[model samples]
Target: MALRTGPGSPGPGAAARLVVVGTACVLLAACSPPAPPQVPAPAPSTESAGPTTVEPTADPWADVSDFVPGLVTWDSALPEQSVEGDPVEISLGEGEDPVGSFRRTNVGLSFEASDLADERWEPGTSSLTPLIAALNQPSLRFGGNAVDRRVWWTSSDESAPDWAEFTIGPDDLDRIARFAEATDASVTLVLPLGHFDPERAADMAAHAERALGDRLVAVAFGNEPNGFHHQSQLDLALRDEGWDAEAWVGEAEDYGQAVHDRVPELAVDGPGAYDAPWWRAFGEAEIENKVALSQHWYPLWSCPDRSGETEERAEPEVENLTSQWLHERAETVFGQGKDTADNYDLPLWIEETGPTSCPGTNDSSRTHAQTLWTADFVMIGAAVGAQRMNHHSSLAACRGGAPMSMVCGMGAVPNESPRVIAQSNYLALLMLSQVGTGELVEISSSDPEVRAYAVAGEGYTDIVLVDTGEPGTDRAMDLSVDADRLHGISTLTAESLEATNEGRLRLLSEADAVPDSLPRGSVTLLRFSDE
Candidate 1:
C-alpha cells in the first residue's frame, strides 16, 4: 500500500476504495487538539443487561512512548486500539461532490414483523425502544424473511396459515405505530408475497395505513422473491413452478397496484431481491409510485455453500476480517445495485444487511471485526449512494444460533431477556452518531489496506479511516502532516486503530491529538470544523 505523496500520484488501484484525507487543519483556539487516543480498559456492561460482558484484553498499548513531532508509532489493540491517526494533507473544496447524508431515511435498523410482537412496546416499557432512540431515531423497518413466511393481515386463532409464525393485526400495527413514534422514526413494512393474494396484500397495507397514518412512509411487497423458490416453507406458499423474474415482477406490480388502489399515493418499494438480475428487472419495470430500489445482502455469511468462498475465506470459522476480497466484493455488489438504481434515478436501499445472516457464528460476526466492517460498510454505502443502509437486528441473542445484528437480544425466551445486549460492533454506530446527519465527502488514499471517507455535516467534516489488513502487532504507522491540517477543526478527539475482542470505549482526550495511518485491523474518525 502506498501514500498519495503528491498530486496525480495515486496509490492502490481501481479495485480499492476511493477515499481522501484531510490536507490541512484550520486550527482555532476552540479547535485545540483534545488528547492522544488511548484504549481504556474494558468496562462491564453498563447499558442494559442480558449476559453482556466485555471480552477482556491484554492492554498491549497501555504504555506511553516518545514519538516524533509528526509520526505516531506503537502496538495497537482496535479502538478503545487507543484513539488517534495522522491527518493527511488534503481538503474538500469547490467542485467536489458531497455524497448522501446519514439521515433517518438513509441510516436505519431493521426487524422482523413477528419480533415486534415479542415485546411489550407500550411507551417507555420496551428496552429496545430507548436504544432505538439513541440511534438518533433512524428509520425502523419491519419485514424480513418473516414478512413472507410468518405474517397474516389480522390476528388469528384459527388454523392459521401453515407458514404463519404470528399474526400482525390492526392492533399490532397500532402499537407499532406508537412505538415508532416514541422512537422518533418512520416505518416501512414489507407485506407478504407468499400468500399470492393481491387483495390480502392490499388489505394488509390498508390496515397498516389506518394504524400508522402519516408515520407510514411506504410499503414493500415480498421479502426476497428471487430466492422464494429456494426455501421450501415459502416455496409452497408462493407462485407455482416457473416463477421467474418476469412472473415475479408481474405479480409484484399487481400487489402494488392493489394496495395503491385503496391507499392512493402511498409510496411503494420493492423486489427485496438479493441478486443483481432481480434488481435490474425491478428497475426496468414501470411500477406505480416506486420510491426506492431495495435489496438484502450478507457480506460475511459463513454458510459453507455460500458463493465466493476460497481457501482464504473458509466457512464457520471467521475468515480474514480485514481482507481485500471482503472490501472488493462489497464495492462490486453494492456498486451493481447502485448502477441499477441510478439508471432509473432511484435511491438504492439495502433493506437488510449485516456481517452474517446465519446465527451462532459468534466466533466470526460478533467480534470487533464486525465493528471494523460496519465502519467500512457505512463508507461504502455512502459512496454507492444508497438511500437506506439499515443494519438488520434481532431482539434474539447475539450469541443466538448465528450472527446477524449488531444489537442482540438475550435470554432463553424471546423478549423476556432480562436485558437486551448491545454487541461491540455497535460501537461503529456510536462513533458515527457524533455527526448526527451529514453528506459524504470522498477520501483519496494511496494505501490499499487503509481507506478513508469524510462526512461534511452542518459545521463539521468527519474524516473516517479504516484499515482492511491483518494486525501489525509490532509496528504502529504514525501518519504525519506538515502544516495547517486542523484549520477548521473546532473541538476534536482521536482514536487509533487496533483490533481487540473487548467491547469498551472511553471518550477521553489526551493532548493535541488530531489525525493518519491507524492501528491495523481498526478504523479512525477525525472530526473537523467545516468553517
Candidate 2:
C-alpha cells in the first residue's frame, strides 16, 4: 500500500528524511542558481549607427622614441652620452685617467691567503691569472673569517711568536706577491679583529706591507662589524687592554691607524655594515677621506626566507626593494642643497652582493638571463652614481661558507669549476668589459620592458638593450637612437633559449642578426662605429 515513484521513494515514515533532503536541495538551489539565459539585444540599423564612428584617445607615450636624440647628456666625472660622430669632443687620451674608461666594475674574489697551501697556491696562481687578465679587476680582498689568527697561527702563544705557522708565512706571501706582480691587480687586505691582539694586528699589517709591497691598495679593519656588533667587542677589548674606544671608533680606527702609519699610501675604510646607522656614524665622525665608505649588500639575503627561490620571481622583487632603498638612502644622504648639479659629495660602494648564498638557489646564477640582469643592475647602479659594486661569492665555491679555493664547485656537487665555467654573469661582464670607455647615452624603445643604454667610446658607440619580461612574448621595440651620427652597427645576441647551450652569446651579422623575431629572455649588445 506504499506509494512509491522509485526505490527509496518517500513512503509511510520517510517524511522526516525527505524534509531534510528537500531542505538541502532548496539551499543548494538557492546557493547556485542557474545562469540567466543570454538574450541578444536587437542590432542597430546602418542608418541609426550613423557611419560607425570611432572615438580617439590621447596616448601619453606617443612619440616617446622621438625624444631619444635630445636626451643625450654630458658628464665629466663619468662617461658622457654623445652623438656617435658629433663634433662634441671630450678628452680620452691613452693613459689619461683610465677611470673614465673603467666603466665595468671588476668584482674580485675574497678569501684568506692562509687557507691556501703551497700546492694549492700554485694552481690558484694559474686559475686567477686568466680571470684577472679577462676582467682587469682593480682590487682584491683577502680576509673573510678565514685569515683569523686562530686559523693562521700554529699556537695561541702571544709571547713566543711562530710566524712560520701563520697563513701569511713566507711561502703563501711569496705566491700572492708573485701573482700580483705577474698580474696588475691591486690587493685589499682585511685584518682579523675578533681573535688577534693589537700587536698581532699591527704585525699582520706589517707583514702584508712587506709581502704585498706597493700592490696593496687598501685595508678594511673588520668584516661586517655592524652586523656582528664587534664594535662593542673591540671596545671592550680596547678598554681591557687600556685603549680608549671613545677616543677612536674601536679597532677599526686603531688598526686602520696602525696600517696607515705603517703604509701611508694604503687606503682604509670600515665598519663595513649592512645597516645605515654605521654609515651615518662613520660619515658624521669626520673620518679621513682616505678611509673610504664601505657597505655590503645582498638583496636576496635582505629577504632571507625567500633567498633560494628562482630569479624569475625573486629578482624583480629584490630589484624593486633595493632600488627603493637605494633611492631613499641616496635622497637622505645626498639629495639636499644644490642646483641639481652639486648636491652630495659622498661616494658609496656596494662592497659585496650576489644572487644568493643558499645552495638551493635557482640555477639562474649560471644562466645568460642572470648575466643580463646583473648587467642591468651594474648599469643602474652606475647610472645612480655608485662608485663600485663587488658581487658576493665571486670566488666562494660552496654555499654559506668561505671560498674553498679560487676554483671550486659553485653548488653542492663539484661538477663545474667556478673559475672556468662560462656562467651568464661571467659572459655579461666580459661583454661589458669589451666596450669602449665613454659616458652612458640614452636610447628609447616603444616597449617598456626593453631597457636601452648607450655609451660613447673613444671612436665608437656601444648600445646595450635588455628585454626584461616574461619569456615567449616577442618584444617589438621600435628603437630610435640618436648618436653623434649614424655609421654602422654590429649586433651581439644569443641564438638559443634551451637550457643546455643558452649561455652562448655571439656576434651576429647584419643578415643573421636582424631577425623578424628575437628569442625570449635575451640581451642584445650593438656597437656602432662613427663615420
Q: Which candidate is the best by TM-score?
A: 1
Reference-based TM-score of each model: 0.75, 0.60
- Poorest 10 consecutive residues of model 2 by lDDT? 22-31
**lDDT of each residue in 204-267, candidate 2, tens digit only:** 6666668777666556665565534333234223124433323336556666566656665655
Backbone clashes counted, model 2:
12
Off by over 4 Å in 1: 1-99, 155-159, 231-240, 305-317, 398-402, 469-501, 507-518
Q: In candidate 1, what residue range of length 10 has the lowest lDDT sum?
A: 61-70
TM-score, model 2 to reference:
0.60
Q: Candidate 1 — what's its lDDT?
A: 0.58
lDDT computed for candidate 2: 0.41
Cα lDDT of model 1 by residue, 300-402, tens digit: 5556554543343624234455666877788888888888888877777888887765445545655666677777887787666776777887777545433
What is each predicted model's overall lDDT from 0 to 1? 0.58, 0.41
